[model samples]
Target: MSDILLSAAATAACLPYPALADELAASLTDSAVTVPPRLVQPLPGGASLFVMPANDATVAMTKLITFTPANAGTGRPTIQGDVVVFDIATGTRRLVLDGPTVTAHRTAAVSLLAAQRLAPNTRGPLLVLGAGVQGRAHVEAFVAGLGVREVWICSRSPASAEALAAHVRTLGAQARVVDNAAAALPDCPLVVTATPASGVVLDARPREDAFIAAVGAFTPSMVELGPAMCRDLMACGTVVVDTRDAEHEAGDLLQAGVDITALPSLAEIVRESRPRPAGPVLFKSCGWGGWDLAAARLAMLRVCAEA
Candidate 1:
């Protein structure tokens, strides 16, 4: 058939947090899915072009986007592009989904899946570091998908933090803006660090049994967790990576000298059906193309059903 374009709103509407999370959970165990290493090419002015492609038995998908760090606070999005989906049999483009929307929702859905399987508690008052796009997506995921009652937001920019907190409040969850995210760690068992930090944001040690999802700092030079805290996470709790890609991209665990190979993949945890560990659970997500593929599949299904 003809190609269909889905805007940001339409893309998000098709993949709600609950259904998206379930799609990701199922894709994790589907052996037919194949995601290759995404290509990141650096451009002048500190911009990056990312090309991520994946496929299953039915459709092939590619997400092409640009990441411009200099755009922060400039009213321009740092990530922008489109996800093109094609029929595997015909090789004809079937759909085009908003790139950043797919990235934001899919990433958050992955985090939700990890939390549902790993977190000690999915209840309220979760602490979130960073108030950017990822930060907002995560808050919506936790509150809507996991039924969190309250959210504690922290960010370097006061205005941004308050914005996120305000959004959280509108979602019917209590929102708190904190000057020190580390200080709020003990009370908020479920924590997410979505900051694009070159150093550390969460410097304090985590509670013995807290669940933390570190989504920012994908490169080795960037990190959100302090060395002491990273070490403590491994020593006192189990650290899981969303995929093997974290070994190369997960700065939080790498900078702390944590052996990523020793950690189990999220797929393993899902398949084995193991009991939750007694200590803290740190889940490091570094992004994957299969997630975008899952988004495409869901969007197509929803679109077709509507048609």
Candidate 2:
């Protein structure tokens, strides 16, 4: 069969968050998913290409992506890629979905799933770091899945941040760009860090009951939360991650000398029905490959429905 193509916009339009969440939750609990570590090939010019493949009972999918941080200066996306879906039963390529959109939706949806079970709401506005794809996507996902009345964006590029802020305003939220990310943290009940920074991004003392979703630092060499902040936040509430692998892959957790095995995975949280703590809770994601499988399967289903 010919491969079906799903663009980023179409993929986002057809994304099934609830179904994807349920699928991921089940896979985590049952260990039915196979998510191999991604193969990374970095170019000499500081660009990186990542190839991640995942499989399950229904489908096998692989995503090829590139990260070119310098592309932003040229008015290009820093992240670009596509996901190829294969029929596990027939061993045939079936569909191709836009990579960034799938990644953005799946990543944010995973965090949203955690937020639903953990810190459901906060008293203040939502603060997001970075103005790129993941940053804007997280904002939209949170506002869609939850009730976000206000949003504050912090970015290295004022133009990008303002652009994202304008988009958020169109989404019916009070959105604005803030100069100080650290300063904005204390007042925000929900904070998302989606930058590519190699060092700490959130270093402030947040609200007693705040929720943090760290989505940027996916490698051991990169960190989003400072050691002190990580320690303080972990001490306040349960720290949940997307997968067990994050314990080793997440620099924020590792640099903080956090015992990853002790922290609950999102699956464990869903399986055990862990009660939300009264204090703060942090969700650190290192980007699970299994989630790609779930997302691709969802896209394939949508393609079939349309056909």
Candidate 3:
């Protein structure tokens, strides 16, 4: 057994996101790999701690994440944690990787994959909700993966949203802070909502051909898309989840009284069983454990390759 560690920056430095996207696109199957629903523990002040574990044949990965929503108000990120990867056969710990970073990258990769299948031709004016870890990561992901022309940023904190927009401009992508995100939706074809708001952050869906990748609201009680959008998706089979486990964890769909089994999984879409449904396709993720394991292993390989 061998052990190694990498900072989030270092792991990100060597991450070939396009390649990782390809890897993840093929990683999920009916039985070969799976991510179980995370075990959750509520914390004081409405914060939450999650212990997630996932495994395949060769290795297993576990991540510990704590969400302190209040931290974002104080100039710190809301999510903090790390990921551990080990040999499954021997059960020996092999690598420890930054947790939130892994989550960010994997979450974005999943979104990108879903978008590739759902709205392969969409371009320009991507609307991103909440300028936090997931929001920032999704901006980079969309810019890299889709060549989006402009990104509209919206957040409860104007300064944080503006700060992210400024950083996004530095990446050669056009970005702006939108005071009214709902009003900005029609202009954008792809939207990524990465917030923990219990109420709807994005009031309306893009009316045209589009994709919405929602990552927040893991618990059954926290929702992001509100009632009408979920209801509309539920009726049309337009909603897609990163995995079947999302049925148990995705708050947006669960709260909207969605029929979990009715929605198709990402693997099913990727494998060609289901065509991308018509209009306002949604990819809701409650955070898949398989994604954590896959990302950690990729980081481990990148670490070794750079040595």
Candidate 4:
């Protein structure tokens, strides 16, 4: 077997949002793929690294592997990443991709998938409570996948919010910048919290018919939504998570006094035949290794085809 290699620039040229979401969803729902246990290492400087191994019988003869290393230092608190793809059958290295862009796409795709399932009838101005990479990606994903009419972005820095909003408008989305989260909450039926805050940023009770996607704070020490969000989730629609194990380990739910018993896995939500509870729905994702592997594999395939 021969292996293919791809760089961050090459991968970006081939991986599109809609296609990535479709591929990831199929891999996630299919029973044939085998995703191995992820290896995680926390650095002394407060950074973290993760390695994921995966294979899908329908996709290729060789298994796909991906490595992601993220760092959020104390001073800068930057989240930088890198992805490497290898072909197991040929023992060849396929690609070295940029982790940040790939992560933004895949994470937003997951959020969009969750929103599609959980918030079927949602409309009006959507609220994004972060202006970082993830925040911009979320807007792109939502515009591509949902029926959002307008977007309101809130960040600590007004300039950052304005910049992100400008980008969103270029993508054919009606967008605006806001100074606070509360101002955006009242009119937003869908709220996404993507900040890197170590404490709560959105504390108000959600609207009766809203949906929330909280993707920040993957570690035990960080949080973007407070106890009120958890309590709201319990009382409202289903709480879907990428993996209950990851959430339990990460402390996003546990730290907020959220009962694990009340949480439902993403698979459960997708398979449910009956009507779900009324009110807002919450989908909290704590980055999973399987997602990285799946996305990397797809990106690598594109690199090979181009070569």
Candidate 5:
């Protein structure tokens, strides 16, 4: 077996969104290996820290280090971090994957994957409710997965929204910047919320037919969806998660009074479902160790091939 290690930068350079998503879905459904649990720590300095560790036979080992500082000076409570990939077989450090970029792509891809299974008939005009890195990744992954025809980028910052719209336009997708979240919501069948907000950004009550992907909140102290969203998810379509253990760390679901018993595990969704979901569905991912290892392993293969 070829032993290859990749740094974060190198991994980012080699891993593209479309290919990564394909690899991720296959890895997620694989029955051979067990995904390791996430390690969470309470930072005494006022930051919440989380570490996701995993290894596939080819990838060797991978670790994703994430930090969410207390919302003191900043209005947003977002995650910031890095992912390190190592080759255990050779004792070689492979690469440091760009935490922000990788997180954005992987998270969005996860949403896209869930959307693919949950809402196959919904074609966009997709609405993205954030203009940050995560939002951009959603746009990329959505187009890659669903052939999104148009995208409406909405954000607290008009200029940032315009910038993202312009960037998306360059990718040949019809794009526009919108200031009102409500105005953007009705035009699209699919919505993705990638903001770092502590409360609901979009009203989930009115849009009963819209499929949503919420990937922003990670801790019990932060929330993005309101009670209505959780209620709808619990009652309507299947709410798929990467792992139940990670959901315990999410502030969005816990604070919204979501019952953990109602949500279905990802593996169950893949194996038990028939014809998939036809109506509104929601996927809340807190990230998982298996995805990190899969991405890292793919990046290492590229690095080894180049060598």
Candidate 6:
């Protein structure tokens, strides 16, 4: 069979947030799925290339992408690449999807899955830090999957933030661009941090029952939430990682010296049927191959349904 190449928009069309979340939820406990550790290699000028591979009984995929920190605010995507999917049984190439699109949407879908279980309250308005690709994807996910109606955006770049606000408005949600994310924290129970920061962006304390999805700062050297905030979450709230790998890649938690071993993972929550926490919930996502696999599987199912 001929391999199908899907553009970013096309790839996105296949992996709707609600459907993608269901796929992720199922894959989390799927014993047949195998996700190997992603490899990150340093590129010239401080950029890095990532290779993430995963497979299940029917489909296998590898996501190859480049992350350039310097590309922030440059009108160019910081993440760019493609995901190649193959038939597990025949080892035949089946599909090629836009990598960055898969990354953003799948990452947000994982957060949505976690929120379905962890968020104390799903009501809006949702506060999102950063105005890049992941920021846009999260806004779409929360609005679509959780029915969040209002979105408050905060970013270091005002222009980018407004652009994100415009995008939010297009999605039939009320959008507000705030200069201070910390100032907006108390009133906003649902929060997402998607920035590329070497230091803290959200430091202020939030409400007692807030739900925060921290997706930025994958490396130990990069941090978005303040160390103190991380500590407070650990002491008074519940911290959930997308995977056990966050113990190594989650900068905010690592910088604060939070013991990740004590925190539950998304997979565990799904498998054990864990309930929502009484206090605030912090979901730390460091990316996982299994998530990409979920996206690919969803897309393939869509492809077959359409055919």
TM-score, each model? 0.97, 0.92, 0.91, 0.86, 0.87, 0.98
Quick one: best lDDT, which candidate? 6
Write one digit per residue (lDDT tens) for candidate 5, span 71-135.
Answer: 52375535666667777778667676666556766777777777777764458888888787788
Relative to the unseen true structure, what is the C-alpha lDDT of residue 179 in candidate 1, on a scale of 0 to 100?
94
- Candidate 6 residue 210 Cα shift, in angstroms, is 0.1
- For the record, the alpha-carbon RMSD of candidate 3 to the native fold, in angstroms, is 2.3
lDDT, model 4: 0.71
- Residue-level error in angstroms, candidate 1, position 245: 0.7
Which candidate achieves the best TM-score against the true structure?
6
Off by over 4 Å in 2: 1-3, 16-19, 120-124
**Where is model 4 more than 4 Å wrong at Cα?**
1-9, 58-77, 271-277, 304-307
- At residue 154, candidate 1 shows an lDDT of 88
Residue-by-residue lDDT tens digits, candidate 2, 1-307 = 2347766677887675666666666666655578888888988798889899988887888899998867866878777989988888889888888888888889988987888788746434889998988898888877777768799999889989999999999888999789998888668889999988667877878877789999999878888899999888777776888888886788998999988888888877888887876788899998877888878767777778887
lDDT of each: 0.89, 0.82, 0.79, 0.71, 0.71, 0.92
Tens digits of per-residue lDDT for model 1 on 138-218? 999998889998999989999999999889989999999999887898899899999876578887887776889998888
Residue 223's C-alpha lDDT in candidate 4?
Answer: 82
- In angstroms, give how far residue 81 of model 5 lies from its true place: 4.3
State candidate 5's TM-score.
0.87
Model 3 TM-score, 2 decimals: 0.91
